[model samples]
Target: MATFTKANADYLRNTLQEAVVKCSERCLYQSAKWAAELSVSLPTLPSVSSSFDADTDSQMQDVDPPPISPAFHFANNDPEEARLEAQDLSRYLLAKSYFDCREYDRCAAVFIPSALPRGPLSPTSPNSNRRTPTKAGKGKGKDSGVITEVGSEPPSNALPKLSQRALFLALYSKYMSGEKRKDEESEMILGPADGGSTVNKELVGITRSLEGWFADREARGLSGSNQGWLEYLYGIVLAKGKTEEDAKRWFIRSVHLFPFNWGAWLELSELLNNVEELQKVVPELPQNLMTLIFHLYASQELYQSTDPIHKELDELENIFPDSQFLKTQRALLYYHSKDFDEAETIFSALLHADPHRIDSLDFYSNILYVMSARPKLAFLAQVATATDKFRPETCCVVGNYYSLKSEHEKAVVYFRRALTLDRNFLSAWTLMGHEYVEMKNTHAAIESYRRAVDVNRKDYRAWYGLGQTYEVLEMHLYALFYYQRAASLRPYDPKMWQAVGSCYDKVDRPVQSIKTYKRALVAGTYYDQGSSFGSGTTAGEPTGVLDPETLYQIALMYEKLNQLDDAASYMEMTLAQEEGPEEDDDDEAGGHGIGVTTTTSKARMWLARWEFRRGAHVRAMELANELCQDGVEVEEAKALIRDMRARMESGRSPS
Candidate 1:
């Protein structure tokens, strides 16, 4: 008989119950090991049988006799009952063995007998049926299933389905089990066992049922009819498999099936960056649908697929003509497109409609500076300037407007004010550094850029500004490092490469300068192609503007070595691109460059001189006459044209 106090008995019983619920092969094996240990420690009863003679001086009478129960009696005298009990225990042992080996099928097969015990009176029991087979020859294999078949119904449908809550309990029971698996030898040993803990069996059962239900549901979902659902499912699976192309295909399919769903469209747009896909789907979508989807997608750090974003403004214009959101989008796009006039018009309209539209004012000011419209930039800066208070970013934007307008002192004031509001504002620090750079304050600029980098090391503009400051201070190597860092972040920026090439030129490496210039041209081609002005800049189409200054340098190389005619032709071609103001007061001054304060008659006179030297008398005369008629300080132009024409008229040209 086992000795037990109230606490000890409760603890042992609770521990045993917990072990049974775990049912893992490892847990079962561990429990059997514990049972084996306890078996050796059990007190064996003296086998005197029913013939207890007086000569047998046993202490059972002297000491308190233990209570006898049917359980103890079955273990002692009944050989047949003992044999049956032994068979019942064999199922648990076999189940544990199968489970430890990860033979789920076999483990489940042996687990049935342990769950459904059999006795002589039990007709539905496997062992009972085995004792007496009906004429139908039932119960052929007792240990071959998770449970005996319930009247030929499918296994899934036949089993009682558990709910999610019940499944959770089952998982928790497995997690809390004190036993360690063979594979988990590195885990810590459990402190002690508890037996009397009554786990909520109902919860566990419900959980198991729910797990089975979800598994069935998932299986059915695999053959789902909805294309969107199927695509989403396949996308997740393919993504897990690391097949990005297959994942992309499914993502696109999901968008095709459900264009209106924001989540689906965004997810597909992110993975499948095919601009043609967006272009095809955008027009078919309802108004504002694309906007909602893209706003969510733009949250990623790397800004991929700019085509959809660039087209969003056009779509918004068609949909919400007078909407504030549409107006802002158009303003931003126009600013990027360098259509400052249109951007100004839109932003002005927004301000007229609502004076408190701060974003319109800020973007309007930025476009004004970028377009070199100084007067308008000043006006808009004043418009956004606040008497009460402003956000740090807004103040930084205002400071930049002033800085671009060459008002460094005023820019510094606003930049300082912005830093006061938000000390960690990286853009403000960057703008302030640029202002310092303009003011030729290299130390101040360096310190400002340092503060900017402290706030945000990834800010390419700040790094570029810092590099520019170093370049100005004649620190070529330091400038190179900072410029390289900035270029890595924004490799598409041609200006950055040009700056890098200039640094090389500063260091007396002309060949390296030439190489870097070529690299810049390549980047410029790519950047311009993707830019709003791509078609004209990259496709050999004319934009009525001179070739870039870097290209002009190459043209200069052609100018050297007495290529006077070629130089004059290129210079004239460059000059021809300079359009006069459309609202000119007089045609006599019609050819003056628009927006230029200085007269370009000097360049015109030089071309005329070049023509005279080349012996193109008639062309020289024509240019000379135009320059002389304008009274633009062209000395002896008439005399030169007359002399050149006279020489050409003669058989020999003038030397």
Candidate 2:
């Protein structure tokens, strides 16, 4: 266990791989490969290395781990190409293992730029660990091996000059290590309570260094080798910072130079914040397969309607028919639409086909949670946690399961753990806010909601949660802003519109309230009918189920503005939708669910009053009598009856 060498690393790797196969643990293989790469003894724990010759490097280069066929997700790649990729993957097994282990510092160290070790170097050379290049005359090259850089230049002539994968890994590992180190420092300085910043201050330092590195390379007439990847990483640093236009430029450069890189396309897609931005950026994107896929993903995220996007996805499937990525995209599109049933079906198939896949199971859990399928969600949580307990997604699934059980405290713990694992976990922050709200910890909920929005402003739930917390505190003005933001993000969501309408009413802006309520009615009917039609009409012509409270509010607003005829008409519409009498304490209030005291009796009472005002004494009397019998709005009903009776007796009514 103390001293390590090529043989010791090989032995340990075989042992670990055996366990991986036996347990069917895919992540374990990654762990084992990384472990073996770092198998050389550390001075603190292991004995010194023995003198090894250059032949070891060539022998190790020839040997590769057993090939694992890339899944159908990469079916787009040719078989020959896939084989080459497998070999390329094994080239840096040691560093890859460290990355999988989350040892970013160690991972970066393995790929740091250094002078190439040519056929020979001085014995006193700084890199004594590097092997002397063996000549063909040396027969011992077959048996004697030595450690070298995991991700140096290309392992084969066919690959890119700089080993782009290794270079990106090296740079990204350093980037992530900087983030980790900064977080540690921040925790020390600001304490955990104020830690987990979304600012990412360390990125600035890396970005500056990358700028200098690129300039030096250009000045020295270096080959473009990893130009695209370097640009992609640079774009990442800029994207995370506020240099919006600069980020876009580099992402474009990255995509143009390396059209096959999915990350470049994805980062560009995320940079587009709105449908307008998306459409504008789409034209700028080079017309390629990657752009087409990015277009589908971006469309799913923006424009709320997925009907057209489904057609687009179907078209893409024609090209990549067996692609699991496309299938998951379709599933994700459904999930975004809140069409849980369809989402559930597709996700279930995807999971069944590849149980070890970890991309979107947290999303599957969310769909189940929304559907109140507790047992299914619980099973998903268990499976996700078992697959990779350290993953942020797994923690989110566990958190959701606990949340469903009404275990708010446990839910918060898991969500916080998810945040600890990945501070940028959008779902964890939003869900944690929900848990805090359930616990009535408004301050904590506010912090979580803010952090969620800071990570990704597109998450409407976080905006809505902030509104809910403010509304609970009777901070109507603040609630109005957040609700409006949420509504703007999810314009078709009835609940968001209703919340906005409710806020307007609370602030006594009846005109605005009436307008918003109408929109809510349209959105509700539009969503319920699964319409592929355009954004619902603002007039809110209900084609299906209607919110009677919204109707009642419209009447109340009309009444307040002295539009008596309009008031009576809306009040009658409200009465048509009412199922039974309600015991209302107030006379003119509409009991909408968002922010009102509502009772069925109030609608009846208001209708009766409106009828009496129009000189319909007999109609008013009948409605008032019913309200009195129902014991709701009794006082208002009695007064209406007496007024009608007196007016009738005076021969000024019921003619």
Candidate 3:
């Protein structure tokens, strides 16, 4: 648990240097073997010293040997080259060790210029150019083809340079460490005195360093495999701030450079709005990358038919026949496709193989519920609750089963347990809200939904739940706000649009209400026949007939606006879709009394009023008489008839 800091710099430096020396010795030994095989006399490498000194002046000097004859030649004796290669290899080892130890800050700190010296031989020093002379040699000898090992001192150009790849990793480590610290600090600070500012500052510093490295690479006109990674890292940095477009551009460039990069592909896929955008890149991607894209497609419900997904899954199965991840994905596709038997079979086998697989258990419970296999679902819930009570998914499945059985109190207990396991479990929060709503605890429902939105703002279900709870409480303005948010998250969901419209009407925003209703109609019709099942309703709920109640409300609004013709048109449409009244069973129930009213009677009353407005008094009077005799809207019918009579007596003839 020891933290990395400037105090530990010496130890870090010494450890890195030792690793470099060891790797260099191994490389030299390999070169010597190669030299022997080539029939060349390599220089007898000096014994690697056990101790290393950071200060140059304190180092023991090597004994200078007699110069070799012209016939004897040494091969590969560049000390600077060996040292540079050794430093690169050593960096990898050191980084891996630090990463394994979870000391990411130390891993990053080791690659900085101040910690790792840039130049072993300083050009500013006069001794840097000086060469030691042997007892038998007075001046420099003629140039020979022989390569000899230099002493421990490196040449002026032999700088301890860090590659951009290493620098990128350093930035990544710093960013991850900073984020972890930020989360921890956020949890500790009650009053919130901005403890995260320090972490943000660290992130900013790392981003600036990456930018500087990118600029240096550009100026040097360097383009290679590392270029892709550099761009990808830059994209990650840009994504941290208000530079999402720039981030996207850099990710695209990274993809162009390295098409095989799964990281870049995944990031790019997230930025895209739809599957069409993904299709443009699909052909260029490898099969493994295609599987990732297909997974995205499946998540978005972009596949209209299972054919394409099944084809892709077949290809993936060939590549990784025993991959549980792929098998689960295939099962999910089957579930979505409404092949419950197939989905259940695969999920059951997966659970049998790994009983503790929470995801499998969750999905299996869902499939069982959808299939109405109540006994199976209850058994699964009991087993999961008993064996894996600590798992959030297990609690969620148990809670869902109880909720379905209309046991709201028992359901809330399990849902709250799931939330206790992970406060940010979005599904549990949303489901708990549903249970609260069922229990008629509107305030608790609101709190649960608020927590869910806090966990993930993009979850449309949480926002919709908040809207519904607020609307039920007659908080129209608050309901409107959350409904709009839900609509933004799921624009294609007609239910969200309808909720927004209803809120608008409640708040007296008639024009906005009308527009939103039209949008709801369009959205409802667009996917009316699609097989995609939403949580709000059963599969393929009839959308051809507009909500009769909504149509009637619209008609009333039009009447208020003095748009008589439009009112009549909408009322006619409502009547056309509305079902006729049922026969009164006078023997079984209390007879149809004076106060009784029916949907058919209401439609007739509205139609009669519209007829009166259009000067069709005869038809209006006939409908009004029929409603009054049937004891349906009797008072309203009498009032309408009285008005028609008064009008006729006043000589207001039919127009």
Tell me, by TM-score, which candidate is best. Answer: 2
Residues 69-106 of candidate 3: C-alpha lDDT, one tens digit per residue: 34332222345434544566577568746755778778
Better of 2 and 3 by lDDT: 2
CA displacement after TM-score superposition, residue 270 of candidate 2 (Å)? 2.7
Please write out the lDDT profile of model 1 over residues 60-97, one tens digit for every residue.
Answer: 12233344332322121334424543554555566555
Instruction: Report, for every candidate in turn, its global Cα lDDT versus the true structure.
Output: 0.48, 0.64, 0.58
Ordered by TM-score, highest first, the candidates read 2, 3, 1
Question: Compared with the true structure, what per-residue lDDT tens digits does model 2 show for residues 1-655?
Answer: 1223444334333433333331122222332333232222112222324322223222222243444334312221234434544565654567778878888767766756432222211235222223222222333211112112234321211113234456566667777777776556555211374544434444644553454455444444443443376777878876765556668877887777655455566678777777888878877776644566678888876745566677777755643445667788888777666666788899999888878777767778777777777898888887787789988889888988888898989988888888777777788888888888889999888988998887787788888999999999999999999999888887887778888988998999988988998998887765542322112222222334366777778888888778888887887777665542333678344333221124456778887876877777678888899888877677877887887888778878443
Regions of candidate 3 where Cα sits further than 4 Å from its true position: 1-103, 106-170, 188-201, 227-231, 257-263, 273-458, 462-485, 488-491, 528-536, 541-543, 579-605, 608-655
Greater-TM-score candidate between 1 and 2: 2
* Higher-ranked by TM-score: 2 or 3: 2
Candidate 2 global TM-score: 0.70
What TM-score does prediction 3 earn? 0.57
Error of 3 at 562 (Å): 2.1
As for lDDT, the candidate ahead, 1 or 3, is: 3
> Best to worst by lDDT, what's the order?
2, 3, 1
